[model samples]
Target: MSKVRIYTLAKELNLENARMLEILDGLGVSYKSVSSTIEEDTVELIKQIVAEEGTGSADGEAQAAAPAESQATQSQATQSQDAPEQQETPQAAQASATAVQTRDDVAPASKAEIPHRAPVVTIMGHVDHGKTSLLDYIRKTKVAAKEAGGITQHVGAFEAQTSKGKIVFIDTPGHEAFTTIRARGANVADIAIIVIAADDSLMPQTREAIAHAQAAKVPMIIAINKMDLPQANADKVKTDLTQLNLVPEEYGGDLIVVPVSARTGEGVEDLLEYISLNAELEDLRADPNGQFSGVVIEGKVDKQSGVLATVMVQEGTLHVGDFLVVGENYGKIKAMMDSAGGRIKEAGPSTPVQILGFSEVPTSGEKVSSAKNEHAARDLIASRASDRRDAEGAQVLRKLTLEDMMGPLTTVRTVNLILRADTQGSVEAIQGILARKESEDVKINVMLSGIGAPTEGDVLLASTAEATILCFSVTAPGSVTKIADNKGVDIKSFRIIYELIDEVDRLMKGNVEPVFEEKYLGRAEVRMVIKHPRFGNIAGSYVTDGSLKRNAKAKVTRGKETVYEGTLVGLKRLKDDVREVQTGYECGINLDWDGAEIGDIIEASEMVEVEVA
Candidate 1:
């Protein structure tokens, strides 16, 4: 007969290896280790012993059952049928109440103290900066190759086991379009690993990642990637990071910096070790037997599987058949799968698992709590809806603009906007201008901002949020416009900075007439540049479409990205300076900035006042 491994037999019996070994020792059976092999007869003996013990325990529980205890459990089950609000009290109160409850009680043994689980780390950085690459190396999966254009468009949660300990990583998209997704990652993570490319140093997305982590108030660890490249400069990256208040520990700052090469798996072990150490210091703990709670990482509706939501267990264990109340939606867990896509009966804290049972897709970051049953779940959802209505009723109705608030009693009106620009700098500049327009009566709420033309997804989001889409130097395609129109979403495009600001100003004033517009003047393409001794780097270019004039408002573009938007400081032809250079003519242009590069396009336009009927 073939010998069976002790660990394999333990798994078949649904027992821990350690517990199996203890049973063997108690039965006077010899064993070497979990990997040691045993005769078939020995396996049978172990199984028999376990079965006998389980049966004995069951018999004892039956004998110990009393009429009074049974009545008490029945009474508690009746109390649970009351309004869900009474059951959703503070965590401490629930824990204390559950501590005395028996298995016969209607509620599961939640609130029981659980051991420390793995730390969840959020990986965030700039696009093409190796955020996914690092996670791919750690997880030994080719997730980057599977992504469209090698850019992660959605949030992904993965679990990896290192020599030090196990860690759960939230791989947030590095592109600026997924700001909300990245923020959700940071909000639920125990730590944030801000991945910065060594060659690129710092980019706009990197700054945004850092800001999100800071806003979440989580400890951050810097991983300087691409260290294998010859042009990689880790020191320069560190120096730039200090400007953002992220001083490295070596430089007397609290931040920890690790130089890593995702291509070669260099410094990866050190990074994992640092994460383990940090998690130890934080003393992360949860009660697997405590009240079940989780956060919705992401959710989607699958045709075959129904509604699937990736939930990270925050407090207790989530089990199959457990009733869950997520936001205003509730469902019983029909099935559960771990990060590895394997079916799991239960998941503990820090474990990311996809659960099937939600009636509808719950928004990301919604709190997930276990319910007693389907009836309780429905009650919870209805109660939450009622509370929301009551809260709205208590607040004064918001007016459209400041002019509508003429009485002594007034309420602030919120104007929600979705901003899309051609570049990150344009988004920042427009946001700065909008910030100055906010007052007590008019509050500006930017729902989302990104760099690119608006897409169908943007339209759907605006439709759900009831927000206006503002495009700055970017336009929506015909298909996107059609969707926006069908969804009844307003889309506004602007070519000049002041024109956009002026429209927003009017919107806040309850009067949007006499709209300010920009007149299209000319456009110039930089053919070459000369480093003049006095003017720094001058862009010598030909007028591609229109004319360039001195003191005319100009915007520089590199490919599809806007580099700068300001007035042209100087425009000259050969030696003498000229006021305007028309199409087919070459001119040397001097701008306030020196970032002019070859193939950059300089667009000239002036803000003009106009009226639209």
Candidate 2:
């Protein structure tokens, strides 16, 4: 009879090689390793043993489950029906209560008296900075080629066994979503490595990683990558990092800086050694017998598995078949795989594993834990869903009220603003003019002034400082307005410079009303560009949609980027002059700006003043 390898047989049995090897040893079968071949007779005997032990299958009929969408719908219905007591509370209250209860169940097990486990390291940095290359060297795999847009699109977890011990790495993708992923990675990480390219060193994304790491309060190591390049400068990197508060150990700071080449694998061993040493000092621990709980590092819906999550166990061991509440979803862990893609029955503390069998993909960083029972898990998750709804409502309704403005009435009055303008000249001019408005009783502080539409970043800064946004000759987009609304951020737009100043002056006396906001009217695509001596640029275009009226403010766009933003000087149809152009009709457009090009898009819009609220 032909022989089968232990690993090949383990895959058929959905068992890890270690477990299969242990079973073989118990059977008194002689084997060299997992690579050793076993006779067909031995395989039959193992199957018989597993069957008799009732671990193989059931004596009943097997029924195919409903499709994924139908099953998800059924689960939602079941959850609603199961939580009657929660229905009595208001939606916001119910959501808040559920969120609290769910969080309590999902919180990682306490570290006290926990057992020691492998350190989980998160690699973070700017794009094209060798973060993935270093991971490739360590794992002996080239995975970057498979990534979309040549960037890691999702957080990946894997483990490597070395002479010292096993190390876990959570490779985070480099994208704008890094804001969330990097933060989550650091939260569950014992150590974070900031990969700085030796040549182009610090970039904007690098600063973002630094801020995330510092906010998470995790130990950070510096990896000076690309030492093989001609422009590589280790001293320059060290100096730059020192200025950014990542002081090197040699420079009397706590950070460990290692110069390495991810391509040639130079200095990698030293980096590993330092990480292991740092892990020793930190003495990270997990309770093997504690309730299995962790956080979702990253999650996505899979057509095959339905919902998949890359989870990192913090305190206890997570095993297949345990009922779990992951974020706002509840399910039994149907299967678990180690970082190596080997099927593992259980995951211990600090172990990152790919989990299957969730009804819905959980949010990254959401608490994941084993509940007392299916009912308990469902209830906890349902509550969390409710709490999230309540939280979102509370955030939206928590706008500044008249009663909250008592500070301006009694104490030293202060109005913090983030100013944005259409031009640098306008920004400078506004800054100079606003500086004159500063008074002892009512000081006006422009916290973060810039030149452009009010952005989400401005909203975040405004939220942080409890400030309002003021912009001139620039309109906030619908998307920006939506975010600002969600954050309860107030954005006031003005056309004339004096109008902006007048509103602020009115605010000192606590009198304010709804301000003007732009409403987009139509869009036209230029098919022909003509120049004239009197008119700067004449654009022959067709109205793509809506109606473009004469003298309406228009924005010219090249591809997806906006190029020129100004009002139309005139509108004409062939030889006759017209007031507007409607859909499916072509017209000649005259603007004060030059350099109008074919294939350019022009969008017309108007500003309408309304009540403040």
Candidate 3:
């Protein structure tokens, strides 16, 4: 006969090993440790005994209902116990019977196998893609109208009750700066809704959102908004999505594409129906009685209140007065408010609530877990701090570079380098020469090219990105070099631009095998347009990433389509001519393409050869 270990039995019965051992002792069973095995007969006997003991109190009311009938039932139960055939019920059947009992009736159980909960959905897409608008229509609120520039700046969590069921929606920002925030939202969500503009199809940010959702491994639902517009083209949106491997259900794939008008509340009901059906098929569930844990969706310091944190409880129920250890901080929950701003004493799994008791503003995406008491919370915090200190002391930071590779390898296709020069003009000239050195198989990426001596910040960035620092007509301070040496970052100084270009060319072809590809410089968003008489349409833009270069090959992207592609003619800061504009700075850009409008993105790139290992 097969035998089961005592510890395994304890786990199946949801009882502590120590408690199980005590019970075994009381029942006169031979068990040395939790690891000891019990025969199949003994296991069944133990299960039956435990089941009887568990339901003894719960059956008291029934026993009192009719004494004669109860006595008769007891006699029958005793008779059934003696019958070998009656005792032949499968172990699984007995376990199922035990699960039907409540936690109050059965002691030491961890969680319950019960009803499934609603799914948590995250809405993500490109800028001005109507993500917030769809959510606003669903929740019957003007959340989109309240934001400046009609764009969401941060992540917002809210619960919506639809005809299908309730869904917790996390509306993430569409801007490029909040890429991390969007990924965090997807990580905590069960399903992701990729909102696409029906007229515009898919933009760069929309593709980024799709990538984030795919990385998180969550099911995606495409929501094509703005269907009420005359220019709305759902078919085009679907065709574009197929290029990203998101085939629609109507096309015989599993993906569901819903075309809806956020302004008129069209096809939203069908979207919710599909979401609810998907959740049902997925069988998404959580044990509310399990250990309380959650993820912080967003955290911020409020001037009126203290640290306000929006957390989505993943498991168990959170009650008022419960002490929580959020990231490195710990505090007792003073108050809890639901998505609708209503005060709540308790919150269960899949519920998003704004809590007001964190010691400090916890970082977004930090795990939130409950501690047994205030002392436990403090102890956890102290232990975490000590662990971090020990790890930092023992950790050796090293950034892997092409020079680090040994022997012959064919994996390195691109070289990541940081460029620093004495002047902007020198930096531009060196970049221009490097751009020409690119081949079909090799490409060089200037991750950071700025005008100044290489500083500690540049060294740190190089170390983190595993990029070599190239200085033209500029030097790195001794302290910065020391730090770079310690971090295994390379700092190469060159007096001439040709020397830097030759080094890159050697690394690309001579030192390593190679090919040339398009090197993306940066992206800028057109905030305003100046209709200059002689200069034509001048795009007043803010650099969002990297740096916008003057006289670089640029493209004006209107939504998913590129409207214009040509060289940028005029790059200026106010009236003064500038060779480049860095991130966070506003400048005037004049390209041969005059179709650049407010909200359109301008991308700058150069052709360069990259090494192929």
Candidate 4:
């Protein structure tokens, strides 16, 4: 057999481990395993094995030993020190040396470190269900007590530092507030603390809260509150909760049910502990180094300040003086205050803070961002507003298409119609008909449709939705009409639906001309009243500045204001009926009223025309 050595065997292989085994088995190398502390006898044995293999001559060994002579004398003696030809085999020696080095490089296994984050808890229930009170109890503050009424008026975010960590609580004023705040609670919070009044069991708000939380896909903790009340029933509350798909932790489910009394501070600590434990299992974490982003919980115009907005920082840090663009508004953060009213220089991820210095009040649930500067913030806000306007315009245009009116339409074209009716049934019927009307170009969108006289809110909603106000057998209040006129919102009243529908159709067909009537400022003298044979009495009056047409709608003016608005039932030129009555012309005008006196001036005017909307 050919003489074999470990280094020679190593040089003839591809894989490192295979090379090591080839050298060991082929050379018949029988030696003790190399320990951490090398023994001199073991080294000698390895040298003897290499020598016995005798793959090279003495002069080749001399050349191999010569290269290591200056570094180590013992290694030089073991290496080939004979012919200069042996120096070419050092690459094989290096490979064998690498294999030996790896044997000593073994390390123990390690575990990965887990990240941590603040717990996000949401307080939810029906209105007046003690959700706010329970949150106040857990937070050890008087947030609910300080509100306008005993109930919370808005969505409030607070942070409570417990023994485990910090727990962020979002207090929404029942399910309506939750839906109003971005239409869902899942978007706002991670865990939901459903507060149910023990005495009431399962109320409408309670079911709404559960539906919202489940829709959000968040874990729920049932807080059976009002245990201090004499009529409280804990078991009934639990059963009701179970009916809403909330199985308690004790009943083979993960949900925790804690009985508490927001009025008496009972079981508050236990509730907090349960939340903390749930958060631990969830392993919630946020990247604090990311860009500052959060949702606007609520906003309002301050009497002292310009626009005050409450924001919940979901990630990164928001500092005071940072330029922020919230929805359509932009401003530098003049001040940052926490829930406790303490001034904060900076707010990290999950911290809810009230900020001052916005130009306008951003809508609740609008995402807020920290820009680089005021100019940048303004540009970003303007860009976002432009984008939103474009999107809304496109949506409106799409809704006016045949495809939008077809079967199984996903997007509904809603034109907010502020309906004011004389009676409740009238309002309901008008709304129902308008809602069912099939239109390829335009559909009715009623935001605030009520039965009473048109109020300021109706005008505001009309202005906001760019919609028209439809009054059925009712009139708009003076203040509301003035506001609508100022805002350029069309307000139309109809005694007949067919006429209104026909007018709307004509308007939609682009054939209807808008009729604008001059306001009847106050009438001059009623002049004289004459009794007629066939018709009723006529008020012969002189023309004011504007021409009064026959059958035109007019208001009966007495002093300086209008008393009644009706059609000019009769316009006769000295017993002869005329179609047109001009200014500076004497005409016999028969008003549509029985109580028209001599002093009561017959003011002629037409109804302000609005495009069918």
Candidate 5:
């Protein structure tokens, strides 16, 4: 016969293990440790006995009704149990049974199931502020004995056993890491510990982290770390926090400020104590017997374990044998392990565990839940995947080149552009020609004109104005490309003059690709950098593989990172000027820019577009 352990039963009933053993004292209920099993029939009997004993008190009856699965049990039982002002009456049992229904009959009904769980804490702040050290100290206490330096290296989540209480700390690399998770819609953190280096006070990333924590509406705790340093200034850190609206409790504000030297383990105990006190007031709790559901911290393939998932349980208990679906992947929990890598058979709310046996790796921060069976898990995965496919299709942009002539714009459609070029004269000429194309049907407007590559500010302006950026003879920085991709703003670059004008005409006419296409020609290696007193920096070059052409568009790169992009001003074979230099030949080249470093590479390309019939 199927059975459950006494500890599991205790968890289901929201009672301590000893309290449950006390209630189960009987001839049939013989057991030793909390892990001892009891028959199913005996489990039901214990529930009835508890119901009988609990009916004497109103609060007990309301809580007892939680075990009932029916229309009647779905009502205001939670409110009655929570509201201390509520009085007990004989009708409390029946009233609790249908409290959820009465809300539907009287007012518009909304259902939300919020159970208590361990506090989900995310550590944030500027990098090198001892965020890692403090977390390492807390972790090593529960996990190891002697603390070795640099033991912490981005383990997603870990549980620490402090004297006050246990806390699940989610360590983030930095504020950007925190925001990346936030951008994915994971608001699992209940409290954010903003670690600030005492001597440094608050940096840009610190302020950004503070704003993110506040935006998430989670309470913040200030940790003034590196207190062991001679120049450490805790007062200055607190003052900076005050400017950001996070005033320390000692400074007449509610925010708790703890000074700690993780290096020496000073004041670290106080921080843990405050976290416990705050958790008590937060009243974190969870229904251990309810449906299993949680958030996925991360999922990836493991060489030894196939697909491994780090899960943070929010409600109910997750057993090893239970089947679950994470995002589009479904699996039965073949094995379970805690953050410490110790084998475990079960995971409770707020506990982070490694789950094995997923068919495929799910996205990080995905929602995870228990399914009734394998088929149910598969069905849930199928439905979720279909929803995602539809949503993604709607958001994808069709790769529209600036030269691609779109159909006549709608009355509200304004072809706003932020124009950039290598010279102010070029910028003026482009803006003048674009302004001339303005007509009754479509408007070609330049929102901003400048003589440098398109910047993040330009991308933001384009995104706000619903426009594209057309850069002439310049390259957008790497940062600009990333932001442009995220914001869905088009950034197209061209070197030739007539090509830009032709593309503008093409876009205004109809949907057509640019008349002139680009062709990659050659590459050259800068073996030496020669800076002339009058003439700009000259590159002693060797045609690496492709030929180098004078007056051709070129990009100067330092290793994999780009330094500058412009036309090659001049190319020389020995001392004489040349139009092109072939492969294996050594030459001297004058690039448009002056910051040419040794070991830089220059790439040459040309514009070549065949007309389509």
Candidate 6:
């Protein structure tokens, strides 16, 4: 046969030419290095040679080329037969061949199977800061118009078909529920649209939403809303966002800042387009074959339907008749409905669907899963329920402070508290008063307390915390009240401190009787020395407000300080121990202060009443 040339045959067929050359050298086959681009043809010739050598299929001309394949195969077989001598080489060559074939198969399929799903966008910001309004504007929906006072009351996710594509928007009360969802690290958003009022700039909930987005590491787009307002200043808002490290896209950064007016529908289209562009850049995708997983957006018990829940499917497919376990409830999927209220048999990845057939309402933000069967679902639900109870019990045990140990032992009774005030200080003062109530069984926890109006956060926290919200000198946004009713979180508002305290005390005591108390009126700065028998020397003072009555209880305070506290032994105008001293008048006050001195501030007051046990 014309010179075996196994290396040349290997090169023509694009085989492992180097390995073939090594085998040929080992087998003592002769070959010459030829200048040619015939590697593919050489590999084919080698295949024919191997087949002809085995089955005698090739005639004389083909047989001449057959020895290369026969020799290479025989060489490889011999290497394998040689055992320890060529063991590593043959195994390495076989592994290379297998890897090359696998790579060739996997590479083409991966590129062809790129995912294309709808972008999930969560609308987040301060309560009533125009988050719902902006979503309504972009979706061309009238959610705000239907709401009692242009406010969204519940967590809702819907899809809006835009010129670019279908965009999914989750509209939750831009308050506590949003934070709770993000805290679990199950961010259902490909992009977070932070809605900020142009006139209001940054507020508490705005800051909280920004923190939540950052914690979830979700890309954010700042929507400077209410631009149509007379007080709206978009530039000021941009500056505020920059301070929070959200530099705008135009400022040579990635954050897209869209100025829009939800009331007037200005720049909403541009906002939608930006969202689509961000989603495109992210290439957000989810695997359809993975196990079904989703976060509960909203859930409730319908008098007619039993239990209803809305869930956003993050992965896999959920079908009708699929058993699901959600929080404490388990159910067979009776029906699946899309956001538009259209009944569907199945929902794939990135779809938000309202499901029916749950035995009990699942809590918002809880994860929902598809189980194998009813028995598995029931078992999983029961297990989860026990786990939750154990966890909550442990948390309650951990929350037991020293106050709980020494507090009055009373039966546990759920008390709903609604809290509101004009300033942070007053709100804190009232909340502190309620929170410090001494009761072992009855815990005085605040459901929600904040400055300004009764927000959606107050209502949601109240619902989840199982406590009535107390508002002081603050009005409830009409929509918030409606949501509170819908969510079953009781709320009450008050303008006076005593009235609020009285109601809370009555609730804790299971009675409507008002508790009485003596009030402190004035404080005095000691300016001169005075005489006293029990204590060596007293001090002359000026009444700051109201009147300091003689023999009344008083507390001594120095420059921005409290030194001593006792009953006022005597109070005198000039030389007489007067019954009382009013404002703008100087008097000699003999306190129980052991070390009386000049320049001491004495606050005169009395203990008229104590909290009844």
**In each prediction, how many residue pairs overlap at the backbone (N, C-alpha, C within less than 3 A)?**
7, 7, 17, 15, 12, 23
Top model by lDDT, which number?
Answer: 1
Candidate 1 lDDT, tens digit per residue, 1-613?
A: 9988676687689885667878878878774445456788888888899899889999888877786698999888888887556765588787877776643334444433447788998788888899888988987832223333442222258787775568988755442323344333325788888899999998866865675555456788899999999999999999998977678765756678899999998999878877876786566778666678888888888777777898888887888999999778888888887776667899988888888888789887677888888899899989999998988776657444434432223667777678899998999999999988899888887766789898665675566555678999999999999988887888999999899887787666645434467878989888898999988989999998878879889999898999899889998999988998999998999999888988999999877766432
How does residue 486 of candidate 3 score in lDDT? 91
Ranking by lDDT: 1, 3, 2, 5, 6, 4
In candidate 3 the C-alpha lDDT for residue 598 amounts to 97
Please provide, for model 5 over 459-518, each residue's C-alpha lDDT reduced to its tens digit, 9 standing for 90 to 100.
655554566788899999999999999988888899997788877776566434446777
What TM-score, over all chains together, does every model reach?
0.50, 0.51, 0.50, 0.47, 0.49, 0.47
Q: Scored by CA lDDT, what does every candidate get?
A: 0.78, 0.76, 0.77, 0.66, 0.75, 0.71
Tell me the lDDT of candidate 6. Answer: 0.71
The digit string of per-residue lDDT tens for model 3 on 367-405 reads 888998989999998999999888887665644455454
Q: Hey, what RMSD does candidate 6 come out at?
A: 20.5
lDDT, model 6, position 528: 79
Off by over 4 Å in 3: 1-76, 79-112, 141-155, 175-186, 397-613
lDDT of 6 by residue, 1-613 (tens): 1333343455445544554555445545444322112244544555765565546644665866779888999997887778756456668989988887555234324632646688998888888789877776765652223333443223378788876677888866464666566434456678888889989998877865775566457788888888898999988887887866677655645567888989988888778777776676566777565577888888887677677889999877899999888766778899987776667899888888988888777777778788889888888878888999999799777854433433344446556465678898997788778777847656664544457887775565555445566777887888998987887676677888879897787667643233467679688887878565665686878887888987777888777777887888887788776898899998877766557678777887775754556
Q: Which segments of candidate 2 are over 4 A away from where they belong?
A: 1-112, 141-155, 175-178, 181-186, 385-613
lDDT score, candidate 2, position 269: 82
Instruction: Rate residue 485 of model 1 by lDDT.
Output: 89
CA RMSD of all predictions: 21.1, 23.3, 23.2, 21.3, 20.6, 20.5
**Prediction 4 TM-score vs. true:** 0.47
CA displacement after TM-score superposition, residue 90 of candidate 5 (Å) = 23
- For model 1 the TM-score comes to 0.50
